[model samples]
Target: MSKIGVEQSLTNVQDALRAKGYDIVELKQESDAQNVDCCVVTGLDSNVLGEQTTSIKGSVIEANGLTADEVCQQVEQKLRH
Candidate 1:
C-alpha cells in the first residue's frame, strides 16, 4: 500500500483513504509529509507566502471544492506516473 499524507482537518478524506487500504499519515508538521507517496491538503496555506519549498517529490492533491472520492482518484492517478 502506498503511503499518503493527509491534513488533520480532512477527517472524511482520511477515513475514505483508509477504507481503500492506503497507509495514511497525519500531516501535523512540515516533516510529517516526508516519505509519503502522495499528500492531501486543504489548499488553505499553500502559496500564501509566494514561496515554494521542495521537501517531498510526490504529488500534492488539493482537497478544495472536491469530494473524497475525487481526491482519491487523483491520488491513484498521480501514483501511477
Candidate 2:
C-alpha cells in the first residue's frame, strides 16, 4: 500500500477523505519538523488491500499546515494507478 505523510491535522484530513469515499485504513501523528506538523496515512494501495504486501510513501509540506481539501487532491493524484 502507498503511505502519505501530510503536513496537517490528521482528523481534518481523515474526515475529508472519508467524505470523498476513500477508505481510511490508518492515521498516525508523527513528530513535527521545523514546527510543521506531520501525519502518516497507511493502507493506500487498492491492490494491497487484504492482499499482498506493498508500501509507498508520499510527503506534503505546508507551512500553515495542509487542509483537508488539499490532502485529498494530492492523495487522489498519487493514487491514480
Candidate with maximal TM-score:
1
| Segments in model 1 whose C-alpha atoms lie over 4 Å from true places | 47-54
CA-lDDT, candidates in order: 0.88, 0.45
> For candidate 1, what is the total of clashing residue pairs?
0
Kindly list the per-residue Cα lDDT of model 2 for residues 29-51, writing each as its tens digit: 22222122223333343222233
Whole-structure CA lDDT of model 1:
0.88
Output the TM-score of candidate 1.
0.89
TM-score to native of every candidate shown = 0.89, 0.45
The lDDT of model 2 is 0.45
For model 2, the superposed segments whose C-alpha errors exceed 4 Å read 1-9, 28-64
Winning model by lDDT: 1
Candidate 1 at 9: error in angstroms?
0.3
